[model samples]
Target chain A: MSEFTRGFRAGIPIGIGYLSVSFTFGIMAVSYGFSWWQAVIISMLTLTSAGQLAGISVMVHPGQYLEMLFSQLTINIRYSFMSVSLSQKVAASFSGMKRWLLGFFMTDEIFAVASAEKTVDAKFFFGLSVAPYFGWALGTLGGSVLGNILPEVLMNSLCLAIYGMFLAIIAPKARTSRAVLCVTVVAILLHVMFVYLPILNRVSSGIAVSVCAIVAALIGAWLFPHDEEENEA
Target chain B: MREFFIYLVILVGSTYLVRALPFALMRKKIKNRFIRSFLYYIPYTVLAAMTFPAAVLATGNMLAASLGLIAGGVLALQGKGLTLVAFVCCALSLMTDLIMITLN
Candidate 1:
């Protein structure tokens, strides 16, 4: 199979998974007094779940423009780390304008799948992006137009789907590698502490998540450094 | 409406820059062993951190969400594909919610 086609096929699950979350986002934007088209437009442009939801919250309030900018920056900062990491994985052909274009579509799920590959090129990355991109926009359109027609229980259940995808990405690797298993455990412990602890919990989730992931990965790297040859192989 | 459009611009610009700048600027791959390993572990750590505690709260009911998490984890460990794992989690969580509703 062609590389682009391979990537597109790999992305189908992510596209399906995005439908529920973006559907919720659409309903939310509409409820916040946005028109259906506005909701669709936001999804098309932002293409992020937490950032867009937070954006809507900020917009509905008497928030300043700086608040919108800072909130999005803070909430979406993890993408920077993911983007930097992914830069190492892309094929040499992906440079300049290609890199910039690829960055626009680098959602967490897409990043995970792309980084899993042996080598990623511009065509593969763009093809991988197509399904989730349209899934997000189309889901928003459906949600805004349909508006909570699905049962609440089903909606709540569907919210778990993304987390399910996350687990699918990590679990098999964790099962095979001791380093990965430790990193996963440490990250989860740190996350739980951040969520339940008093003052620490006050930190915004975006920052908290970034810190937890960084610290856990640091410990994992220090303890179980991989052979350079193994990584490239 | 114009104000909303301005806010949207700010939102899109900030978020896009966060994703773009690092990928664009970091043209050369780091050869450092530690940093490369760190990068290797980043996806797993980040995904794990994002999934837990948050996934517990995903379905509103902790019980149902936990069930979904277990189901997803087990299925994934068995080498199940992403689509199956995700849909099964949703279905399991929904069934748990429905069963609880019927009982209540």
Candidate 2:
């Protein structure tokens, strides 16, 4: 309701979710034989789950750094797309400093929540971001420090928590919008077909899904043009 | 130690390069229609790309992938969040693998 309340409600889940994901990353880093502080610093600076995960294999195999770099770039490049969408929501007069700072934290979840807001003020978005950032950094530190303390079964269970986190974000949006529903369904169907097709096996799953979703979205947008009313907030 | 620092420098530099440059230069409202269309579909494409291979294939078998898909799809249909559903389905699939491993 109130900005403070809304900020608090939105921030808590992000905080809890980041805590777990970051913890997993930290454990992964340590398991890969990186120093605890190296893991913590990576989590803090990158603030990206996938990037950090991929960083490990890269760290382990120095010769593969080039391939790792390209792969991470491919996976995380979508953030630039998120930033472009967020340009409208961000304050026109936000100081250059604020823009730089906010851009650093321009994550998928943050962009989703901020872009969907009724008011596109800079302060509110910053407030929402603070909790998740703190959670992620702390979680990495804690997990790395606590490495091997937990049973393998439990640790493995927590690792899968990430997929659940993704489902939570998309499902709600799909329920309200038939457009979203159709797009998600189409994407899933295409995913299955691509995965099963013998000819398409050469392509990585990431590339295949990216191609299918982009095609589906263009078709969806053409079929159902956005109304001015729906576009606002 | 020098190698580590070199790696760190490259990693940090490369990361900042990818993220910071666009924000600095792209102050103008993104007016290009083609660019706008590209941005609109990219997230969906990225999400689908990230989700299917990583989560679904992590299990190394069709049964686990199917279980994951069902779990993921059901949670997705019931209006759960992306992170939650992805995490649950992945966990379920992983647990299935662990059990199968133990049994075998």
The DockQ-based CAPRI class assigned to model 2 is acceptable
Instruction: List, in the given order, the native-contact fraction of each candidate.
Output: 0.82, 0.32
Residue range A1-233, candidate 1, lDDT tens digits: 88789889988877987886677677767767999999999999989876786688678865467667765765576687678778887888999998887799988788878888888888999889989999999989998887667777877787776677778878998998898999989999999999999999987665677688888989988999965443311
lDDT of 1 at A111: 89
- Chain B TM-score in each of the candidates: 0.77, 0.64
Q: What is the TM-score of chain A alone in each candidate?
A: 0.70, 0.71
The number of the candidate with the highest TM-score is 1
Report lDDT per candidate. Answer: 0.82, 0.65
Name model 1 segments beyond 4 Å from true: A1-14, A24-39, A48-94, A107-124, A144-147, A229-233, B1-11
Per-prediction DockQ, in order? Answer: 0.60, 0.36
